[model samples]
Target chain A: MDVSFLFGQFLGGLTTAMFLFLIASGLSLVFGVMRVLNFAHGSFYMIGAYLAWQAMQWLEPTLHRFWLAALVAALGVALLGAVIERVLLRHLYGREELYQLLFTYALVLILGDAAKAIWGTQQLSVSRPPLLAGGLDILGTTLPTYNLFIMLIGPAIAVAAWLLLTRSNAGRLVRAAALDREMLGALGANVGAIYTGMFVVSSFLAGLAGALVTPIQSIVPGMDVEIIVEAFIVVVIGGLGSFWGTFWGSVIYGQVLSFGILVFPSFSIFSVFALMAVILIVRPWGLFGRPIR
Target chain B: MSRCRILAAACLAACLAPFAAGAESTIKIGFPMPLSGPAAVYGAPVTKGAEMAVQEINAHGGVLGHKLELLERDSKASADEAVRLARELIIKDNVDFLVGTLTSAEAPAVSTIAKENRIVFIAPTSKSVQLTSPKNLHPYLFRLASNTDIEGHSAASIIAGWKEVKRVAIIAPDYAYGRDAVAAFIGYLKKARPDIQIVDQQWPKLGQSDFTPFITAQMGTHPDAIFCDVYGGDFVTFAKQAGPLGYFKAVNNRLVDGGEVGTTDEAQALGADYPYGIWSDAYDPVIWAGDEPPEHKAFIEHLKAFTHEKYGSGWAIMGYSAIVALTDAIKKANSTDSDKVSKSLLGLTFDTPVGKRTFNAKTHETEMGEFWGQMVKGEHYPFAIISNPKYLAVGPFTD
Candidate 1:
């Protein structure tokens, strides 16, 4: 009956979309260049939140700098990502895609349990840095300051990633590989290094996304399931291989979430899933996606 | 040939001693809890409490001269898996009785199956009111833990006493537990204070990390107080994100209700300043001060020692009470039969870790009254320092 309520719902959906994009981009990068459908991608994001919370606790009393902690957290996760890839994932590259998917999927179980062990089954969170704790008080309605930070971070990361991919030789190799993997190998490129790089960057993106949202969500063990499920939804909806498509898909998803709640309180979550199903039936490869096969 | 025959005789005798001991030993109770899984943090302590109670009872000349033997299975807070484990314990392990299914959801599944098989089932941590209701129509089911009704009444009692609380806004997970809790709480409050207005109510899905929208919507109403019934990791998330938005601090008063908040450690982990001075209806997580009842003092000191020796937390207290309730029923019943045990459980009077517990035949569930406390130190062990809180004993509903 009311149009303004409809508009409010749209904004809510958009906010949810922004977070989904951050998760899907990294997942798509690895899936695009390498054939690994890393189910552990969600774990990386979960770890990012845990590590940031841990870092914040240690640094808060002494350093008083959340930014410093945030940076260190992101970098720490990146290093952790590289280590995991080298030790476990690297060897599995030549294996079948199903094996890679299954292996990473198994990692989800282990990591989920391990997090429970290390974190003691308690929920932990880092504070939003003092500068961003309060809302901007938009007109009569209030928007969370942390949300604005996330909204900006999503696009900023996209732009930075695009620049890196377009500008650097490493980026060129990654794109070339993503575009044509066998050709890159035939062209005298040591595709193994490229795969490793792509995985590291991808995992790093996951970690960064985790670290960024530390202020806004509590980190817990089973949290991986929730984050990963949402990540897959975004990846599938945005298309399996398109970064920009992932961005738009996230926007669409966020809107679905927000408006879903406003339009029909009972079925907001279901609405997004329904939209995804419709999209898949019409375009199996996703909105802007090319089929990997 | 003589040496081989003698060795065979020795092996048979060694195995038979325990079996022979079982005939003389108290009725063996086979129990399984989530000792090492997602719910282990809660399940492990409960096992300790139950085991300790079983040990204490046995030391006092056993349950009817038969020592209680406990066989525990790890359910890992899963339903199907828990039922499978229950079957293994019943048919394969041959546990004489079943005692626990950690979560509310899992309790019904295992209890339903156990009821069908004619085994007495007891739940330690299940807060769902469904198990004890007459709707089950089976006589073998029992629950030791207090349900949402007790918790809701606790909130109502506090609300009744408060001077500044008028209108309330409610937020809880959209699930059976959440709905039950909200319904019971609202019912109690309405009965206690007819004038209190409920401005807004928000129900978010379980395991959801985002609460900004709900928080925003609640703030718009600007109710004098807010009630949250969501628990576990979700409570932690709600508090953390809501804090950044300055919603809790800005709200005049708030009441947070969660099973996880029963522990001070969980509160501390959310953030040092979490629940941020909010009032909660939870377990009193401290060694009570002043001249206390002898039994209460002894219970507190014994639990402290057990916790220290076993790296335990406060959660072990409830499990300890379950053990107490079970033993009390067994000793009073003076029989080991499942039917007799089920009858003994109904209207049984017993000393419990949370205080005196009495079950109603109508509900088949015992009451462990709430421990109300405010968040203190916000982020530390023993964060909740409660004043002398009341333990209200009420009967189950007609349903």
Candidate 2:
């Protein structure tokens, strides 16, 4: 492929990678702190996308109102995550992870039917709030402003979380729990409250991830199934429970999708799997995975 | 009155009403369609249309003194569900005629059930060629909808006409529809345009939301065009993502089909800028969108009348057309008997918004050709309009 065309594919991969990061990061944070896979992370992402679209439609004033709406929509989804955790997920805390998976999967079915009942099985879209709809001309291709915004947001969230985790006191507790739950419990950290708080935070992150991608991809019923598959692939490739590892995994996946096809068209779809195989074979714990202490 | 006497009278009335309804009865038509699942988009329109046919038939003083009562159950597009529902419709609902099933998978299952029950089975949605092909086990089956053979020829011919088209990529939902559409499109295109290379062919499952990796892979090969047989939300999501990713713009042309253009609900999911140069078959509202080319005026009027009298437009009309066939067979037979109706339906022809739809006696496939359209700015329709339509019959379909 030529330079410009290759770059276009790279950009495409990067944009996709950003969403993967959002999903994987949330999934990782939950596992890192609470040791749950949050199989319904995809559902949260789906719900957030729908809710974000709904919120914007409800608040439709003008073109410029969208950026603010997008932010608020993310916040709104974060609140939804909090609610979901408090009401439903909290009950699963004392149970085994298998039960949690089943519960969340059940929630996926319920939420999907609920979404269909409320929204109908119609394909829904939210216009780019007018202001961000236009594209930037790059090497004769029009790159959507919304996509660029999404890619930018991935690193921004990653950095922000890193800072919060390292610099803040809550981050200390999170690290403490990540190190050893038994020790933290003995230290009188009110482990149950911390775990609940962790679940809410993880759900919020997943919701935010969904809200971020709405402008890039359309929201429809069953969006969760697709999004979750990609998220699972990323999380596995990056090594489970490693926050920053998700960052690298997304980029690697994006690049694989971009360059794999260029090199070999027929086998390209299997490219991500090939890389994952190599990663697992070479470093089964993932490039950055830490043993559970 | 004593309780026993009152109960006896009420039971007698209840028993006699169905018997009375049955004695003066029209054929009890039964249907099980995916009224709630992914296939519901097609099933809903089809059911509504068939019901309208039953209504019109019953309005004309019942067929041979029997008023038609339509019975329906939602199959949700699963073969298992369709079979279960079909059994219930046949055994309990006591339907004399059976219809429905949007998925080809469910089509034969229901048909087999109908065959065992000896009910005339007419599928309004299932377009799998094997349905009535003598090879199919159920000889009692018939469908008035065009099959994939005609679609393949039409699609191949459509691609041949495009100037910038060279290498064509195929992506379809990996099922009967997908497999058939790819086979037909490729077969015809190879025959029509030997120079045009058939590039990558990919099939994703139905209800799949992510097409990025698939689309990205196709884009990498840098094919001249992409043709998709994906429908419903699958089409909508693909279009929305593909449109923004410049997947359409990068190619010389793109073709999206599988019954999406007829409805606005899913079309709205693709947003305003639907592909302009792409070719897709649908009963386009464009005739109402008004460039008023030739007989389109009368056609538009007929379409509006039919739609208003049936469904607003699109699948509603398609469904209505299918029902028209079923009801017409019953009318001609002048009986509610399945054997009689089935015999009459053989070698049947009728006028519809989709043009003259006739079924072949041997194949039981509709002979009406498919229409292909180009996108244009139409006043009435929100999305692009389909202008140049093709009428290719079941001639090219062998399987």
Enumerate residue pairs that collide in model 2.
Answer: B25-B66, B26-B66, B26-B67, B149-B397, B374-B387, B376-B385
Per-residue lDDT tens digits for candidate 2, residues A137-179, read 7875556777787789899989998998999998889889877
Angstrom error of the Cα, residue A254, model 2: value is 3.0
Per-residue lDDT of model 1, residues B145-164, tens digit only: 77877776666666656768
* Model 2 chain B lDDT-worst window of ten: B283-292
Residue-level lDDT for B45 in candidate 1? 70
Docking tier of model 2: it is acceptable
How well is each residue in B170-255 modelled by candidate 2, as lDDT tens digits?
77777777787678777777777778997787665676544665675676677887677877767766676676667877774566
DockQ of each: 0.39, 0.29
**TM-scores for all candidates?**
0.87, 0.84
